[model samples]
Target: MNVYLAEFIGVAMLIFFGCGVLAGNSLKTSGSYGAGNVAINIAWGCTVAMVIFCLGDISGAHINPAITIMNAVMGTFEWSLVPGYILAQIAGGAFGGVLVYLQFIDHWEKTDDPHAKLTIFATAPAIRNNVANFFSEYIVTFGLAFCILGMGTNVFLEGLQPLATGCLIFLVGTSFGGVTGAALNPARDLGPRLAHFFLPIAGKGTSDFKYAWIPIVAPIMGATTSGLVHNALYKGIVDYRLFAMVGLTVVTFIAIKLASEDNKEAIKNKQALNQIA
Candidate 1:
């Protein structure tokens, strides 16, 4: 199979299962409504593993751009191929998200919470703290890239990488995922989010473009720096770009914090008003 085509298929599979779970959990009329964290946690991990199992041999099953970028950073993947792979993943994810939306077309009217409807397609912050939400994405994605590299260095059973990623996703979800929904992949969130924005879904809220940059930028920063970190610790290679990236991230988030204070307060006040009403 063509590698780009494989990536498209792989990520579509990812969104099919991953968003499929969210759809079930979020749609009030769905059987899996209120299935809660355990269901999503397991579904995401299993979905990743399934994508890998089906497409690992073809396009390396890089359903996530973060993974694709990490491979490029580590020199295992071609930088030239990176753009195509990422584009394919995003398109595929959007395709899958739309399919799931159509599958539950009736449920949209049945479920009144626009936020819940949005959750079926994209991630949202549990607490809406831009700085912390940004930091949390980096933390989990760093773990994701770092551990994936760790897995690469060691000898595991021939078919074990998928399972390893599955378990790792489970860990990422249960641990720091609550803050940002662990959106470690830009394509996973952005693709479906774009769909949500343009598709005219009934009662859908803002696509949350203001918060979108965190998932895209933070995950890339985390994944790439983890490659640098892995090289420093494991290969005794201290890439100075690692420190540069860190310094830049710190400055970036500080600015984000300062600029977002009023927006954050407004959001909090809105929530408070909702509670009072």
Candidate 2:
């Protein structure tokens, strides 16, 4: 299969399953309602794992710009191919988002909450603060990219590593994902956000373009930062586990600090309001 074709197929699967979870959850009377955070996280993680299994050999099954960019940075992929891959991935993701929307169109019209409709198509923060939302996406993507770098470097662990990487994403979503809905992939966010903008949906929130840059910029920054860190630590000796642990820990620490700061800010704001009232 052609690389672009593989990217299309992989990204289609990603958005289908990824947004499918939201449709399942947000649509009233659906079987997945109240299925809660664990389901969404596991579904996304498994979506990545499944896509990689189906298309890894064909196109490295990036289905994500961060992954493609990181691969290019590591010299695993040619720079010229990056744009095509990213375009295909976005197209596929948008296609998948449209499919999910169509599948749940009736439920969407049946509902009236704009936020609920938005959730069906794209991510939104639990609390709407730009700084917190940006940092959340930044940290999640950073951890994800760091893990990808560590796992992708191991020659003997090719097939199994994708599954492990998927689990890392799963954990990121479950533990720290609540703040910003864990949009760790740029294609995953932008493609679907675009779909929501174009698709006929009732009461969908604004596409939030001002905040849209977070997922794209942060993931690339996180991924590149990971690559730099890996190169710095690369001693011509391959120790996959050690590298993974160290890289994951560093990213996780950053994410936790961001989250903690956000919490502190929230508390301070509440206290200030109390004092005034």
Candidate 3:
């Protein structure tokens, strides 16, 4: 199997179970309806571990672009392969979304809330606070990257590494999933979002494209930062990329705050106009 194909399949399976579980909880009449956070988080972790177990030897079971990017930046993965790996992961995510859609075909209409349908395929901020959402995603993904990288330093038995990594995902989910669903991977959110945009799901709402950048940008920032920190700890070499990325992350946070304020102002103006009418 080609490495790209392996990545595609790996991520496809990852989303199949991860998103499928969410669909079960959100959609009506499913056995796991309203299964709640514990179920969702554990399902995500188990899906991740299963994919890594299956694809670990073939493609290193990245299944997440954040981890791939971290490896590349940390000098473990080739930069040239980065684009293909990411593309494969996204494609896999789309395919996985399709599977979940089919798995819950009957439930889409049974589910009346467009927001729930949208979250079935993508993530949304629980509180709609952009700055807080960014902080949540960034910090969770940062922990994900930092811990996964830290795992590489140890010599785990063959099956244990996948379990450890999966447990790490569960930890992140259980701890920080409330904010932005803990989207620690760009492909994890983007691929399914593209699926949501294109697929024929009844009464599905906007794909929330405007908010999509948070998942992609925050995770990349977190991953790069984690790589820099891990490198410092492991090799003690200060890479200039660390400073650049940190500066950029700061700028991004400020931009999010500005955009959020603009959105609030727009809502206020619209509300006042409604009062006049």
The best-first sequence of candidates by lDDT reads 3, 1, 2
| TM-scores, each model vs. reference | 0.91, 0.81, 0.95
Q: Which pairs of residues collide in candidate 2? A: none
Give the TM-score (vs. native) of candidate 1.
0.91
lDDT of 1 by residue, 108-163 (tens): 88888898888789889989777888889988899888888889888888888899
Residue ranges of candidate 1 with Cα displaced over 4 Å:
261-277
Error of 3 at 54 (Å): 0.7
Give one digit per residue, the lDDT tens place, for model 2 in 161-235: 778867987988898878888877788888888999999887776887766777776676667656656666764
Question: What is the Å distance of residue 78 in model 1 from its true position?
Answer: 1.2
Could you tell which candidate, 1 or 2, scores higher by lDDT? 1
Model 2: lDDT to the true structure: 0.80
Instruction: Name the 10 consecutive residues with the lowest summed lDDT in model 1.
Output: 237-246
The TM-score ranking, best first, is 3, 1, 2
**Stretches of candidate 3 above 4 Å error?**
273-277
Candidate 2 residue spans exceeding 4 A from truth = 153-159, 235-277
